[model samples]
Target: MTLLAGGTDLMVDLNFGRKRPERVVAIDRVPELSHLEGNGHVRMGAGVTYTRMLAEDVGSAALREAARTVGSPQIRNAGTLGGNIATSSPAGDTLPVLAALDAVVVLRSKQGERRVPFAQFMTGPKKNVRRADELVVGAEWDDAGPAQTFMKVGTRNAMVIAIAGLALVVDRPRRRVGVGLGSCGPTILRAPQAEAFAAAIFEAHGWDRHLTPSDAELKEFGRLVATAARPIDDVRGTAAYRRHVLAVMGERALARVWSIT
Candidate 1:
């Protein structure tokens, strides 16, 4: 049996005869999966559509920006965040944002509830650890703040698969930084070395101060981010090109988040 929410990815599979599930359960209208709430932290239901995310400012700035680039208006209206999580596509626009935020996936089963870190949720391309009996109800994360952004390089300006995407977040309170990479790996990847390098700079410069990293530092950070990618040569782009795109996007995303000229 298969579950259906937005039907954006699943419908494509069905239409193309890629997936012929013996049973398909529609859960788009389940009230429990449509809530969006936030205080110091945010909890967005799996059924929350990209359109809703953009209108309501559901997650972070990066998330809102990613939502804005998802697809056509109609696709945004139907494509749900939970559906994106369920599909676990490497190129899913919001995946990198979620990774940068360190969001927690909330899965519910008849037995009880389970929460999994976003890092551990996706095991491979289009695969996750969700059990057959589990339903991905929502995702939750602490507010990162305004110093964050998401950017992607695609074939065209709109409605195109990303060649590479990057999400960068700076947590002032924690004096830490995060970089999430997409469309350059089998699964969304966090750039640990790049994050550590940025955090070190933030520590030295003072988190509250506006400090511009040297060109060499910025370039090295980009290189570290590029090194984390596990890409393959595909129709969208080549592995080398993806790495280059990731490096550029990573550097620009960090610079943008820092408000650097």
Candidate 2:
């Protein structure tokens, strides 16, 4: 049996004969999965659509930007965040943002409900730890402040698949920086070295003040982020090109988050 929400991803699989499930459950109307709530830690229901994500205050700038870039307007209207998480695609625009924000995946089953950190949620491309009996209820994350942005490079300007994507978040209150890479790995990956380096710079310069790193520092941070990717040569692009895109995007995203010119 398969669970269906907006059917944005599942429909394509079905249309292409990639998925032939004996049973399909439609959960779009489930009240528990349609609500978006909380403040300190924003919780968005699985059934929440990308259109809603853009219109509502989800407490993550990166998430909003990611949502804005998903497919076309029609796709955004029908595509759900839970669907994106369930698909577990490395290029799912919101995945990198979720990773950067350290979001929690909320799941429910007959046994009970459990929350899994985003880092441990996805095992690989289109694979996750979700059990057959469980349903993805939503995702939750702390408010990382306004200093965040999402960037991606695609073959075209709009409605295109990302060759490489990056989401950068600056948690001023925690004095932490997070960088998440997408489409450049088997799964959404965080750049630990780049994060630590940026955090240290933030600490030294004072989080309360607007600070810009030197050109060398930014380049090094980008290099560290590119090093974290494990991309493979595919129809969309070459592994080398993906790494280069990541490096460039990582730098630009960080600069945008810091409001650097």
Candidate 3:
């Protein structure tokens, strides 16, 4: 059965004649799918809507920030994080955030439950590892208290898909850095080199909350992020444009997070 939650993705496909499913199962009312819990490590029900994410602390500031950029208010009220994960759109706003956070995706089926790292969950654009009989129950991650931010280059200020996007997470306590790329590759990608570069800077700066990275360091970090991206020209943007934007966004996001106390 085709799983249905917020119907934000599925309904669009239906309306556009892109999908014609013979049957669908509405999983939105499943109690287990609607709860959001935890602190040290957070669990967010797969059915959690973007509206709920913004309404409540969803464990990560990066997630909350990404949730706000999903779509218009009405769409946010209806779109579920599970749906986004399952849909596996390269442009899905929250996927990069989840990847950057290194979240775990909880998949359940009659066979049993299995946990997969977010990085391994999606194989390519609009493709994932979920079996036909399995359902996405929720996702979880250890809380990395960091100054985090999400930014995307869309055609408009709102209600638009990303041309190229990036999620920057600075876990000062752990002396770690994460960079998640969106709409710039076949799947959501993490910039390991950039992350390592930034983390080294954090280490050098003693992970100081008040520390501001030098302009040269930030530029180098951005360059690394851009280099990590494997983008293709699409209707939304050219590959070269995406690379340039990713670089700029990487530096911009890092700057914003660093400015936070």
Q: What is the TM-score of each candidate against the true structure?
A: 0.96, 0.97, 0.97
Off by over 4 Å in 3: 259-261
Q: What clash count goes with each model?
A: 0, 0, 0
Global lDDT of each model? 0.90, 0.90, 0.89
Ordered list by TM-score, greatest first: 2, 3, 1
lDDT of 1 by residue, 1-261 (tens): 899998999999999999999999999999888998887799999999999988645758889999999989989999999999999999999999889999999999999999999999999989999998999999999987778888999999999888899999898876778888999889999999999999898888888888777888889889999999999999999999999988988788777777531
Kindly list the per-residue Cα lDDT of model 2 for residues 1-261, writing each as its tens digit.
899999989999999999999999999888878788867779899999998889658778888899999999999988999999999999999999999999999999999999999999999999999999999999999988889999989998789889999999998977788888899888999999999988888888888788766888888888999999999999899999999988888787777777531
Please give the lDDT score at residue 23 for candidate 3.
Answer: 95
Cα RMSD (angstroms) for every candidate in the order listed:
1.6, 1.4, 1.2
In model 1, the number of clashes is 0
Off by over 4 Å in 2: none
Off by over 4 Å in 1: none
RMSD of 3: 1.2
Q: Candidate 2: TM-score? A: 0.97
Kindly report which residue pairs in candidate 2 clash with one another. Answer: none
126-195: candidate 3 lDDT, tens digit per residue? 9999998888998998877758889999999899999988988887766778889999999999999999
Tell me the RMSD of model 2 versus the true structure. 1.4
Q: Model 2: which ten-residue window has the lowest total lDDT? A: 252-261
